[model samples]
Target: LMDVARLNGPPEAWHLGFMLGPRINAGGRIGRADLGVRLLLESDVSEAARIAAELDRLNSERRIIEQHAEAQAEAEALASLGLEDKGAVIVTASEGWHPGVVGLVASRLKEKFARPAFAIALEPGGIGTGSGRSIPGVDLGKAVRHAVEQGLLIKGGGHAMAAGVTLRKERLAEFRAYLESALAADVAEARHVNEILIDGAISARAATPELVATLNRAGPFGSGNPEPIVALPSHQLVDADEVGQAHLKLRFKSGDGATVNAIAFRSVGQKLGNALVQHRGQVLHVAGTLTVDRYQGVERVQLRVLDVAVPDHGPAMIR
Candidate 1:
């Protein structure tokens, strides 16, 4: 493997380590990621798609659970003694919150405030467990490693932006103090508001089938590897309608006069969706995930609406 990687790059090859391989993790925490492993090892596209859909459905369910935990975490953070002042936050509950969802909640909090965050839902007894998430330029996993080295934490591991740990449940207070001490004055005073990072202006003509294919090389995107966000000057909002209770589906006529359908999921009171619906014929900057959508036998690219802010304004990110 080193030789193969070296051929592609250099002779001083370094083997990347994955603490918890994703497929193994999916099985340990969730039910079955073996399906994905099998799909990958074999050239089974249809079966792979079917299995992947189940995984996506599982993730969707996980998202719902995460949202609930996040609401509680926000309140907990606010109530903590001078927690907001610390620049980093750790929210803990003695075994009531779902262990699986703590990491998700941490991620939400991090996104909501643009701070390093950790969420713990460990048993109050002997062995406790937790997961964490972090912001850009901060490595929660390394923080956990340092804490463990100092005997402040027990068993913990993760990549740059996320981590999981196990320790004495009684040590929650100790852990909190340690993290505060470790992170204090480590970060600058840059206020982080979640904003979509756009990849400059792209015309509908640039969004060709071939371009979409080429752009997809920068994918298998998740966590750190994110899909690029493309912004248009303004597409004519030919028709807009509400769908799925709160969602807004809009059909846009691009500069090439081509029709592109975009859907803003869960955007009722949401700023972008509401703005588009409230003011028809208004040009707004839309930030969204671009994807190829296939219905029946037809294939087309569509934007998975992310945020909409007034044009000439900064990008919009859902906090």
Candidate 2:
């Protein structure tokens, strides 16, 4: 899997870290414990190819599972927020969810709502295995251990950013309540101080292939280090359409008359998609990371949109 023939340039760290990384992780995530390492070790060309293909299939299945769980978790999170004005953490559990993918789902929910989230998978015997992802400054691990000490969780431990828990299904509600009370102050502080950092403001014309290449040097972005978010200020939405099931493809134009392309993945049915589709010909500030998109031997800079706001609305903040 060292081939970069189809890639625009030599593979950057992200290609190996994200694209291939998930395939390797699928083994652990999906219960095929040895599949990932086996793929890396198989020397026979045909055998390695087969393993790679199977891993790819598993990764795709993982995405589908994560997507479904995320949808359910997001819905629950939003509904819970409606009931409590200061909802700090979203704890969702259900029977039959693949326990392996719950952590991924929690990550997606945390990203969407800017809150600490936990997804629990319940087994037949009233036992649950849960994974959680937390926002900065919230000690998810400490809280989990505290829950164990308080007898709210059967067994649990983790760090500030992530955690794992095993508890009786009956204790789920108690654990949730414990976390809400334990993390209330920290979550509130995190939300109030959380701000999207913009690295720079550039015209659509300035978001070029060269710029994308330069940014890749600083990446392989994940957890603590993230890809930079830049603003395309005052760009008017020109063409907007949904592509690949739920990704919203967009074209924006600056006053100087240059056009740039963007896509908000899995956004077709969300607020961002609805706003963009309705914003034809309207000027807005868009923020996201830039990537070099290669298709059919063509390479171009495209923005993976994260957030957008009216020109007068100021920088996007999550609060």
Candidate 3:
């Protein structure tokens, strides 16, 4: 269904995977694997709609669960590993955390701590089902599989970006030690590598639906293939506010009076979100991906903010 939609949908619509993938994945997280499959296979329109609606509800529920689990897991991880000082990986486990949501929690940890991370859901009999997420240079799957071969894990496997594990509680310490020893070098290298590549710099007036469509022709973008990151240099921040739990929404204006809307998802309470909320009217160099958002049957370009930096004090020009 998504493949067909990507093939025929408008360039902007091709990115609908972001909108639909999470809803489908929610079924698995909430213990309803069959729901995602059913939605894809259903031939009846009414049945499909019903399944879609149910999935949407599950996705919402998953978000609430994820938020709670992530908070707890992050605190545990940081306390256990002094992540703020120097930590390469965070491996945290607790009884009663949902197995389906552990991967999502681990991903959040990876982003927050800037390192590979694991979130384990310990079950009865000291056995655990764990999921881990990693930064670009860390091979989490290989590390997990290696532990399995070394008899540290009962069973586990994954790719470079993410992985899963099954193990007894007795081996938890040994497993943690093993991962730190194996991945420390890679994690250190990844952390030190900071290369920011921008596709182009455009003014607020140039950000339009036409530009978004043109830039998206080379992409049905998601995951490994992301949309472009461009800079809006020296734009004045007009207004900033928190919305939808932890997202930062902003209004920006250019010197010539052009304005644009932007958002930074899951950034509330983080550095970027706090800075945006506090620094109204500041001129900053904003970096973000261009996306088109549609509402009330109207489409407009929106910048999905990635980062912000103080503008250079020299003459104003696109860097």
Candidate 4:
């Protein structure tokens, strides 16, 4: 599978999550539920390759399906929340949505809105299956269990960060109300404290593959152990363009004539993408984590951008 994807180098947490994990999960999401397991347990190399190819195809299909559903869900959320977006949770339901992709839609909503969100796929008989994703400090699992006990949900359970549900379409309003009331305080607190914690500052010249490897000795970064975020102060945005699936690809140049490639995933149509495009050629403060991007047997440092700021008048700082 790694060779099929042109993935070379030691597999990191990023590869596991963004590259391999999606293909593995695609079987359950939009294809045969047992395909991933079958592939894993298969001993024949040829059969395994075939299964991997099927999974890759399914994952691609899943992306197309997810993109359509996500657009609809976003529209529903906007209509429900209005321009103010004054809501603790976003609940979007549609009869046309596929159950397999609701979780992906929910996750996108959560990221775009900065709050807990649910996307439900309503069946012909008014039954719905939904998935939800929550922001930090909002205990969605606890609230789901409470709703189950209250008969608002047919069945639902998960951890603090994510969950799944079954319900009657008739009860969606009640379920939404319950979540908003129950989680409002917690969500408020979480968003209030949600600020990027920068570890240090560096320049394009200093952000080398060697430095990234040394920093990554801290071991796999994930939910509990997040990748460190560093800032590049007063770097000029050399170029910016919208790339695959609404991602913003960027190039930044430091004062000393060093350049780095960066990408803001799923930032197009968002505030951050707009800012970067609008301010092209202007100096700004960029913050993100560095990763080694290997392509065609060559490895280079790439930034997974998190946030950006307009620099206040000052001397450029490189550390």
Candidate 5:
């Protein structure tokens, strides 16, 4: 797998999560549940390679399935909330949606809508299995448990960030209502102060693989300890192209002729992606974490874009 990805150095946390983890999790998502474990336990290098290849294929298939489900769910959410998007929580369901990918759909909805979101797969028997993802400050698991206790769900439980539930198809409306009412204030507060806390500002010329590696020494950033978000203020968007399902691949150039590659994953058709495409060739303030990208034995710094904005006056300052 490393050879296929052209990874010649030690794998970083991003690679583990974005590259290898998804492939391993894909087996459980849409293929044999034990496939990942088998590959890990296999002592023979050739056999492990075969399993890894299969896992990679499964991950590709999962992405296709997830993309379709996400599109449908996003449409449903839009219809529910209208142009105002006034809802605090988003809930969407469809009869043919794959159960395995519903969680992924939920996650996409959460990110795009900036709200807790659920995607349910309705079975022919009138039972719906669903997954949900939540924004910070919303205790989704607690809300789901409350719903279960109130007889809105057949079964449900999860942590704060993600959860799963099963309910009668007839109860989806009640479930949605319960979550909205239960979480509205928390969601409102979270959104009211939803600010990207950038660590610092830098130019495209200053962002380098060594700098990213040094920043990474903060060690294994995640939920509580987030990776630093650095801003590229007043950078011209030289290129923006859709790539690999819904991701936006981009190039940004600083005033000094330095350029950096960036990608906004799963942003297509969302506000961010739309803004980027519409404003191509214009200067914008971009904020995201820097990472070292290895391709074909070459190392380069790439930004995993998180947010962007247009300057009100001249080039926007990070402060």
Candidate 6:
């Protein structure tokens, strides 16, 4: 029921996952997971919705907290091992960092670097809990699982992509050492943030009603399954305008002369929007997902712009 409902709802699986599971996790991360679980398992829809909203708010707050911790982790990582350490990741903790949220940080690190990441948060009781994250090629969850099997960790279990554990405060150094040795040969990737692998390029002509239906066949893409992104050649700008507080609206004409609608959400002050605005008559590379925007009761196909690059021919000079 949840799966079918999610398929019909908002597209981000992670956010949806949070909707079902992590709302309860918010309590656990901050106060008590048991409370979060109880609110959902025991409450009616209205009560549950209130709890979920609180949890969502908490997650947003968690982001602010993690931002500081991430900076500290990156600094510590750079200071101790330098910026080039590709084989290992760091999971340090301070008095203020919460154990429940450490794993999220670890997951962020893993996603940011495309390498194994460990994040531990120091608890007031002199204990620490941690989370680890990994990508496809590197078996990060398994690496941590190996330590759990060897009894190095107090308790641990999770999926292949992410895992969690508990440990005594003093075991921090040993844990890092154990993880380092466990991943001795698996550190083969470079120190670069991995970009989303583009499925293939497409022509504006391919953006059609029938094609959109075909693409929907590959639906329910989230987490494991990703939405397809199609790249097109530079298009002529019909008009460009800003919307909301931080969105850019673009009217583009395909090579075949069909006009297309594009939106750069949350891109008002970014390089991509600037390039699009400045190069009104020029060309720019655009990457984004196919979305249907319902406006005034009509549905229109719009590109949810993700990335833009300066054309090889460079920006056009306009006075």
TM-scores of the candidates in the order shown? 0.64, 0.71, 0.76, 0.77, 0.77, 0.62
Residue ranges of candidate 3 with Cα displaced over 4 Å: 1-28, 33-68, 220-226, 312-319
Per-candidate count of clashing residue pairs (backbone under 3 Å)? 0, 1, 0, 0, 0, 1
Model 6: what TM-score? 0.62
- Candidate 1 per-residue C-alpha lDDT over 1-319 given as tens digits, one digit per residue, 9 for 90 to 100: 2112211111132121111123234442445647556645767778777766666566555556666767778877766736445546554555566677777677666655556777877664667777887765666788889878878778887877788888887777888887777665443432453456787667655655566787789888876787887876577666667653455666666667776666665566655666777656666666676666443455566666676666555444323
Model 4 C-alpha lDDT per residue in residues 1-319, reported as the tens digit of each score? 4323222233352355456767888989985889999988999999999999999999999988898999999998998889887999999999988899999899889988888999999999999999999987888988999999999999999988999999999999999999999999999999887767789999999989999999999979766687889999989999887654466778899999999988887788787888888889999999998887776577778887888888774433211
lDDT of 4: 0.85
Best prediction by TM-score: 4
Write the residue-wise lDDT of candidate 5 on 1-319 in tens digits: 4223322223353355457867888999985789899998999999999999999999989988888898899889999999877999999999988899998899988988889999999999999999999987888999999898999999999978899999999999899898889999999998887777889999999999889989999969876687899999989999998754477778999999999988887788888888899889999999998887676567888888888888875443222
Task: Give per-residue CA lDDT, model 3, range 117-178, as digits (tens).
Answer: 99998998899998999987778888999899999999999888899999999899999999
Q: Model 3 shows how many backbone clashes?
A: 0
Best of the two (1, 3) by TM-score: 3
**Per-residue error at 67 for model 4, in Å?**
4.6
Task: Quantify all predictions' global Cα lDDT against the true fold.
Answer: 0.63, 0.82, 0.82, 0.85, 0.85, 0.65
List the pairs of residues colliding in candidate 6. 28-33
Residue 316 in candidate 6, Cα distance off native in Å? 22
Report lDDT (Cα) of residue 252, candidate 6: 68
- Judge candidate 3 at residue 272 and give its lDDT: 72
lDDT of 3: 0.82
- What does candidate 6's lDDT look like per residue over 1-319, in tens digits? 2222121123443234335554555666776566666665855888877777777788667667777887777666666566665446555656677666677678656645546777887788877787888765556667677777776788887766678878778888888898777765555543333344456666666666567667879988764677888765676766678754455777667778786677765455455667778778666666677765443455556766666655675533111
Lowest lDDT 10-residue stretch of candidate 5: 2-11
In candidate 5, position 65 carries an lDDT of 88
Residue-level error in angstroms, candidate 4, position 44: 14
Is 5 or 6 the stronger prediction by TM-score? 5
